[model samples]
Target: MHMADALISPAVAGTMYVCSAAAAGYSIKKVRMDTDTKKIPVMGIMGAFVFAAQMINFTIPGTGSSGHLCGGMLLSALLGPCAGFLTMIGVLLIQCLLFADGGLLALGCNVWNMAFYGCFIGALLIWRPMMKHSMTKKRIIISSILGCVLTLQLGAFSVSLETLASGITELPFLAFVATMQPIHLAIGLVEGCITAAVLVFVYEARPELLYAGEQANTRQNVFSFKKTLAILAITAAAIGGILSLFASSHPDGLEWSIEQLTGATELSASGGIYRMADTIQQATSILPDYAFSNSDSVFGTTFSGIFGGIVVIVLCVLVCRLFKFFSRKKSS
Candidate 1:
């Protein structure tokens, strides 16, 4: 769930920023020490895929709310936790500053809620333990579903806690939690299923690309590395460029929760930092709300999805390369 600036006070926002930055810093250190160049391309393509997948918000039946694939577990499952976290940051950062999908001030909260849990807890705590001995389709499905569900529940709970701690909204803590958790539970189920399908495909195509696959069969599969990448790239482009047009119009889980409490999708806040964050976001957001400013062409959504995916891919790859460069320099 993407928190807006109105849901948090400056103090809470700053605290989250520090915490998220610390996580990012730790992730960077881990990545720098990693010498696996194989994950570099996978990281970039998977980041793009996640970005594209998020553009389409699937409707949660009977709830009048929609949810998109969070992709954290998916990323962490494919790329190890550290690279997964970094790639997730790349996706979220572009969505914030470029697409205006999430507020600038609340980005730290979003990152921690979305990226940290799935990359760390979901991968390390759940998926790895479940599949440590072997990798099988059934294990992949179970772990993917369990990880997505558990991590999403935690993420939703974190939102309620952060909002209550901020004390900016009039939302009652218990009521908010009750509403958020169940709806997200439904969302998490859907995401888990989607994640399973993708992971299974990758497992069949190139099991060696997965975390524990090195211990398993490394024989030739139906798909080569380049073939798998091409397939995933094409799928991402199709989803972002065309399928995004069919996304649900309903408000997402976070906005829906806020609307239930305040009868509005967002609360208004007035503060120096709030104003400045909004100003900067407005300026930097080339495609606000994933559309052309003051236009209703609908192609704007297409353009945004494709453009955002490309940007995320480039950004993730660049970050990986930069880290590798510094890592080499240190070693030499």
Candidate 2:
């Protein structure tokens, strides 16, 4: 869930930003030690895929709430935790700066909530133990479900806790958490299924692409790495270009939860930090809310999806290359 600036105070925002930045720094160190540079393109492609997938919020049955794929588990499964975490940062950054989908001030909270758990806990704790030794479709499905549900549960709780810590909002901790957990539980189930499907496809096509496949690629796969990347690239383009048009119009899980609490999907908070962040976001966001500034034409959403995906891909690739550059320099 993307937190708005209104939900956080400057102190809380700054705290999370430092925490997230530290995590990113640690991940970069780990990635430099990870000799498998072959995963760089996969990181970029999966980042784009996750970015595009997030644009289409699937409706949760019986609840007015909707949710999209968080992609932490998916990316971590393919790229390992360090690379996956870095890739997710790219996705969130692009959404924050370019698409205005998340608040600039709350960017740190969003990254911590959405990316940290999925990449670290989901990958290291759940996916590794479940499927590391024996990679199978059933294991993939189970790990996907468990990872998404557990991490999302933690992420939702973190949101409530962050808000409570911020003290800007009057939402009761117990009630806010009570509402957030269950709705996100539903969202996680759907995302898990989607994630399982994608991972299964990748496993069958090129087992080397999976985290466990580092050693599990003993058997030959039909599709080459290039072929698999090509397929994923095409799928990402199609989803962002075409499938995004059918996204649910309902507010997402976070918005729906706030609406349930206060009967409004958003709360307004005014302060120097908030206004400055908003001003920077407004200036940088060429496509705000995935639409043209003045028009609601379907093309704006389409353009945003494609353009955002490309930007994320480029950003992730650049970050990966930067990490590699430093790694080589250190060796030389």
lDDT of each candidate versus the true structure: 0.90, 0.91
- Please identify model 1 stretches exceeding 4 Å from their true place: 325-332
lDDT string for model 1 (210-280, tens) is 87666556555779999999899999999999999999999999899989988988889888999999999
- Stretches of candidate 2 off by over 4 Å are 325-332
Sliding window of 10 residues with minimal summed lDDT for model 2: 323-332
Clashing pairs in 1: none
Assess every candidate by TM-score.
Answer: 0.97, 0.97
Compared with the true structure, what per-residue lDDT tens digits does model 2 show for residues 1-332? 99999999999999999999999999988888776667878888899999999999999988988999999999999988888999999999999998888899999999999999999999999999987578888999999999999999999999999999999998888999989999999999999999999999998899878887655587679798899999999999899989999999899999999999899999999888889999999999999999999998999989998999899888877877766722533355
lDDT score of residue 331 within candidate 1: 57
State residue 139's C-alpha deviation in candidate 2, in Å.
Answer: 0.7
